[model samples]
Target: MDRIAFDIAHLLAGGLVLVSFMMIYQDRLYALLNVFALHAVLLSLSVSWQAYTQHAPHLYVTAAIALIFKAIVIPGVLHRIIRQMGIHREVEKVVGVGVTMLAGMGLVAMSIVLMLGLTEAADAFAREDLAFALSVVLLGLLMMVTRRNAVSQVVGFMSLENGLILAATGAKGMPLVVEISVAFSVLIAFIVIGVFLFRIRERFDTVDDVALEDYRGEVE
Candidate 1:
């Protein structure tokens, strides 16, 4: 690949990682949801650039899917869910912001080291993309574990899926059918999770996982 293509891809992938960090750093549910939207937008742009550089037209459809469903539709739905649930206060964090940020930095470093070592035969763009993608995925998982709010956890899950799509598009010849299947599966998960969130709120009067734990303890 040319220098320009490589640099653009690097920039977009790095932006996704940055947005993932932003999501974890956010204390409010609305802020986290906004950052998640930005993450999806970055993922869509990165995939579009990948499609251009790789000369794969099918990947454009994947980009569209990310842009439409993830960036716009999903975030909009999440905003409404939070509104209906009346959860506009700051979300409870299992870890401090400083600790979570330090952990995220460590995850990014580990991903870079691991991907570079394992993907020695891959091209520079692919290697870098995979590294950033893994970083985003790890950060998403970290966010999910460190946030007590159910809505925030859903955002984390969606961000993790963004990373998976990034890695898939970065590698050559990922089947469009598989990408479609993954997208649909995510949509299904979103629907299920949304329903579950409302149910949790209805039962416990709060959308925090701790309520579920308490209920389980009582049942036991």
Candidate 2:
């Protein structure tokens, strides 16, 4: 039973990392949002599995928050925002898909090497989960760096947070308050970024980060 539970948890965590890779190659805004929603769904499942295997019920609330807010509400709101701003169909890319994917694979390899080395004395489950979480986080950073759109950058930031949540829940004896705090912090970030996106659109008539940088006299 323990081995089975560990395998399931590993599968879900790996699924989250896989979805992060999928997010990297999405050039269209709507498609990126859809993939992000899928990422959140995978995260929720992973967290719920952690809750079950660890017998920690508060993690369920964390999973539910991921489902309701990250998976549904954030994507829905971002879709509407992009539609209203008239950039729903715009395709934005700052790096070639091949390069970004190769970089992502390197990050994953680095994560596995670093995590396994650091956690040599830790349980196998936690070590694997932490490695996957680090990969997700690094991939999210890569996404943010390789996208010129503010909306896509926001998705990347949220994906990074998903990795943090996964790492927290994977570690045994994590407090409920910490999980709740992390969830609420992400909610606050989403709200702030949503408003920021509108403000950017209002001033520059687009959400391209390059435009905003030029407007601020910053050379990109």
Candidate 3:
């Protein structure tokens, strides 16, 4: 409840939202991966700050998981995947960048207004974190929907999970079991996506999901 603690939490949460916008703005696959790595690093710092402020040792574990797995392992795997798949071109988008940016701004505005109105009695830091986390989640979803490439969509999904972690650590009494589950879930999802990437590339010879639309079989 200290003013300084509130300010720091707000700043970190706001950085997550800002990075979500950066992801939406990135066109190149490698650039988007770099931004996603930044996103994970911010999430780790935010969680560590939460641990320090809340005096929760378990959240530090969460922060380490974010730093180690998300920031280091996942991005490395993704870079390798891109290299192996020869998908070094600019990411194709289903919509224009300007329109997507407008939509992302609108999502942020909606999340702030909605979370603020709904959590009036919550702690100031929690209220701000929830608002920003919601914005990150929305922007991540927007990225997934707007990008035609599978790997970029995977990055969006990971970004969305980072928002969920921010929300969990911001609020009180999240079980370590749940945090572990979430981390493992992301790993499992990455594995599944990696397998699918290879399979899709083998069959379609491309990871751009848009191309699959033309090959869809007609319903009998």
Candidate 4:
């Protein structure tokens, strides 16, 4: 039963990572936010399951934070921001969706290889969990770089942080860093992102970073 719980948690975490990749392909503002909310839900479930399987109640607090902050509050704020900003149209994509997905896959492969080497001779469960976490992190970075939209970049960074939380939970004897830091980091990020989004809207009437490039004082 423990193994079954572990496998279920693994599946949930992997699903969240896959959803993170999908966020890269989204071109609609509302849909992108919805996808992020779904990803958060998956993250909460995964962490809760990890807490259950490992008998680590500390992780349950992490899961609650994810569910409340990421899944509910963040999305609520973003939705209001979008509605008030009048950015209901489709978002701007710097690259074709297919290319972004391919890059995401490459990142996943690289993460797996690096994790396999770094966690060599480690426990089997730790090895696999860390690999997935790294993949989610790298793919999140890929999304941030490839997508030229402010909201999507925020989503990407959140996904990266989610991966870090996952890795922290998987590591043996890990402390409260995941539980505590996530709240602090997310709170800070939300405030910064809120200000940035408002500025983006004020500058271009939209949150598309590509459009904001026109205001860059540097000529290249």
Q: Alpha carbon lDDT of residue 181, candidate 2?
A: 42
Please report, as a residue range, the 10-residue window in candidate 1 with the lowest summed lDDT: 198-207
Model 2 lDDT on a 0 to 1 scale: 0.82
Best by lDDT: 2
lDDT (10s digit) by residue, model 3, range 1-220: 6889888888899999999999998988899989989999999999989889888888888788888878888788777777777764588888899999999999999999999897458867678789998999999999888886777877888899889888888887667635563666578466647655555432232445565556665323
Instruction: List, residue by residue over 138-210, the lDDT tens digit for candidate 1.
Output: 9989987887776776778888878888998888777763466366657846664765555544222334566
Cα distance off (Å), candidate 1, residue 115:
0.8
Could you tell me every candidate's TM-score relative to the true structure? Answer: 0.87, 0.87, 0.88, 0.85
Which residue pairs collide, candidate 2?
none
Task: For residue 2, give model 3's deviation from the true position in Å.
Answer: 1.0
Instruction: Please state every model's RMSD to the true fold in angstroms.
Output: 3.2, 3.5, 3.1, 3.5
lDDT of 2 by residue, 1-220 (tens): 3888988998999999999999998877899889999999999998888888788888888888889888998888878877777663654677789999999999999999999988468888888889999999999999888876777778888899889888889988687635564666577566647655655452223446665676777874
Please tell me which model should have the higher lDDT, number 2 or number 3: 2
Candidate whose TM-score is highest? 3
Q: Please tell me which model should have the higher TM-score, number 1 or number 4.
A: 1
Query: lDDT scores for all predictions?
Result: 0.80, 0.82, 0.81, 0.77
CA deviation > 4 Å runs, candidate 4: 183-193, 196-198, 202-220
Q: Return the TM-score for candidate 2, rounded to 2 decimals.
A: 0.87
Model 1: how far residue 6 lies from native, Å: 0.6
Q: Which stretches of candidate 2 lie over 4 Å from their true place?
A: 176-193, 202-220
For residues 1-220, could you state the per-residue lDDT of candidate 4 as single tens digits? Answer: 3678668867987897789887887888788888988988888888888887778887888888889988888878878777777654576666789988888888889888887887456887788789899998888887777765566667778888888888877876688756565776667466647655556552233335565566774435
